[model samples]
Target chain A: MPKTIEEINAKIKAGKAVVVNAEEVIGIVREKGIARSAVDIDVVTTGTFAPMCSSGIYFNIGHSKPRIKLEAARTYLNDVPAYSGFAAIDIMLGATALPESDPRNKIHPGDFNYGGGHVIEELVSGKDVCLSAATYGTDCYPRKKLETWINIRDLNDAVLYNFRNAYQNYNVAVNVSDKTIYTYLGILKPRMGNAVYCCAGQLSPLLNDPWYKTIGIGTRVFLGGGSGYIAWPGTQFNPSVPRTEAGIPKRGAATLSLIGDLKNMQPRWLRGVSMQGYGVSLSVGVGIPIPVLNEEILAHTAVTDDDIPATIIDYSRDYPQNLPDVLGEVTYAQLRSGRIRFNNRDIPTASLSSYSRALEIANILKEWMNQGAFLLSQPVTPLPGIESGLAFKPLNYRPVERNNSS
Target chain B: MKVSRKIVLHFPARLVEEAIAYRLVKEYNLQFNILKASIIPDSEGFIVLELTGEQEDYDRGVRFLTKIGVNIEALSQNVVRNEDKCTHCGACLTVCPTGAFEIEPGTRRVLFMHDRCIACSMCLKACPPRAMELHF
Candidate 1:
């Protein structure tokens, strides 16, 4: 029997079963979407059937020895993981075996109608059920399928309930679409603190993949508009920091020293010609994940507005009980020493000399994001380096005049 | 280095006499020549064209055909598999052009050996149960 929801909750609370977090939910949803979409696209573009046989035949002789064999050979040319797994014949015999019937007796070659009209039914129902259960069980909780199922069910229930509360509080319809979430927040519920907090925990599978590595940095940066801003890259850094300098502040770099060092860090990927002008900065002394950590700091700073200077100070000092308070102290000391500012506002303006360099940087960053950071250390013989080199020419970026309407 | 090129055209048999094939030859300004133009029966209606020209010109001819909305696909000589609903009765043994299918001894099961299949499709037309197919 399946365990009750209450029992599952108790197990979770007791730490006997792991609870599914927002990140895991988001990852699962993303992977499912990707797999389904890829399957559809491959079918449409290639016009190829999935390798698994859709039809099978089974012949049975009533009451005597029943023999079952698949009509078609199972082929694995299509690379479908679902069809390649184990399958079995679940035979349901209608009547009892006759005493005169011999189990090993083969039906005569010309006998079409014999043995009290036997019925043969082929079963295909368990294919999808078994495949789905196995994939989910192994991927999420290799050791415990029931525990993972319970945790995911609980998490999904919580998210749905939270979304419902958001809908009621914001005066929006229950069917509000995800595409409209950002717009809704911006217009109808910009100041709703609970709505924002609720959304932060809602795992969007369409937006996140589990296999995709993500680094959440919680750090403070100056937005330069008198308000601080938070930037969450969602995934890990495109260009990961080198391992040697990972978590260590560069010597004598005062402004960044306040930010905790990210030891053994690496950029997520390399940039190509298409993307330019995107890099992240981190303080040497903080222990936050570079992506979300930086964003959280920005969020806190943005709330304070221009009253606060663009300093790398301990934003969590007031809430001394906060876990990040220890790192906040180091950040504050670095800010006092003028080691880190809120914004790196030194981006060069568009000009002949700077345009090319900016474009080059943008391309490098773009390639990095698309290809991932794992390929960063590989030889870049086919592509040009981020800096100017012997083979490739520097990229050019010139601003075009905008169309002015009457 | 120079390389010779050839283009294989596929179309409905009824359209073989049309001016499209001749016009393609003149447009490329090539030493165009048709090797064999034939119609495949029972394919609804389709034609095949084999042309020889310079590699560059052959590529240009393909693009021209594509622009004119001609359905062109690479022609590969392979066994084609066709399936029709079968009633489990073996009756095509007599008319089979190739002895590709035979009944298993004592089991009455029909077995197909693809190697002996000539893709003649005679069994496809002969089978009363309509289970035989030409697979490529």
Candidate 2:
């Protein structure tokens, strides 16, 4: 007995829907079989909590006393530079943006203590942030310099619009060279001393709906502990990547562009991260609910860590050089076991993504739906699938020819 | 009752030239292994080391060092993890030389054993949220 979004919503409205998290669905499917579980389960919630670098927030800081034209001005939020090219008093700040005083990697493994991510976190936490802008004076708007403290409450509109986030799959980073390398995946010790992989595996939303069966544009999700929407297919979205028999991508593939109200977010779910050598980034919590429309969708949600394989890549060599060669392959089960066997060496494995936090998020979303406070929303349009022939292309570094002969 | 513990010693400028560690060896009959040290002429210095001696002798030796203006404190007291700040991401698990951090079985929660930590300070940099803090 297949279900529909309309049927699921009716059940949710009447407080009769059966909602389970991704972790619980695995056991349910094993105990009741896919056919029976599909009829029993109405929704399966998934979650992920990890550093998402390609995220930013745009906010309209209302207006100044003298109405300075901020569109043509230099803007900063708590010492970190922000983009003010949009409209008057509107500024955008990226998670990775750094202040001018940041030493960067000059001092090996620089301590990026504070940056745009911290500013975002502080704003969401209800802390006052310093906003300063300097612009060339205009006839209509004479003010050129403005400095003030702004809070999320004072802002007219603040939106968290991430261009790319919630990666479906990623590489297990390791360093085979003699020197340690600091990367966004965390520090990779020399001679493959440690392996760092980031992903929630089965609890990840995209992994539960491989091939974009239930998740798509306009899909509602729990973002930063609040309701959000999938704005579009994330940047570097490559559906043409090779996949397993179950349709799970073996490498970094697929992502989501998310949008939500910044004022409604929580400090716990939206954390500011300072990656020792690798600047700054935001750790966002995202959870999506997959309406059990059919047995196939229910079976996909049952995929566990053992069923998903991740490719191991050497960050010291191949990753920096952009080479496609992979060291080997390992399953999420091996990663979670604390140690993985690679080239006859037992290397310790760690995750930048928090499995416990992911589970908590999944549980929270499940509670929301089970209590009939949250309702499932159907996507207005489907994302590009494997048949879309979409390819993630690299930039071609070519010099522009000068027409000096003319 | 022989006891072994890691402690840090701070020496003033006047005591920098004195054979302080030698006094521990000869007078107190204590064995010391220096883990890390920073000393400069005519300046205050500090040393991190493991001291082994009899329980009574160890107490007396520490009292003697304190009497001589040498500040003594446990090495483990310098390192601490902020519970509220930690998201339990497990980033400190691999970089930790002493394997002080572990993910609990079943619950997947990251557990930090302070007794197992050697104060290597690798976790302070490896932790994304800066959860591991150093008081020194």
lDDT tens digits, residues A148-263, model 2? Answer: 99999999999999999999899999999999889999999999999999999989999999989999999999999898999999999988888999899998889999999999
**CAPRI verdict on model 2?**
medium
- Model 1, runs deviating above 4 Å: A1-406, B1-46, B49-58, B67-69, B73-136
| DockQ of all predictions against the true structure, Cα-based | 0.01, 0.71
> Per-prediction count of colliding residue pairs?
71, 0
lDDT (C-alpha) at residue A323 in model 1: 26
Q: Which candidate is the best by DockQ?
A: 2
For model 1, residues A142-196, the per-residue Cα lDDT tens digits are 3211101111111111100000000000011111122211111111111111111
Q: What proportion of the real contacts between chains A and B does each prediction keep?
A: 0.00, 0.86
Q: Go through the candidates in order and give each one's C-alpha lDDT.
A: 0.24, 0.93
TM-score versus the correct structure, for each prediction: 0.16, 0.90
DockQ of 2: 0.71
Native contacts kept (model 1): 0.00
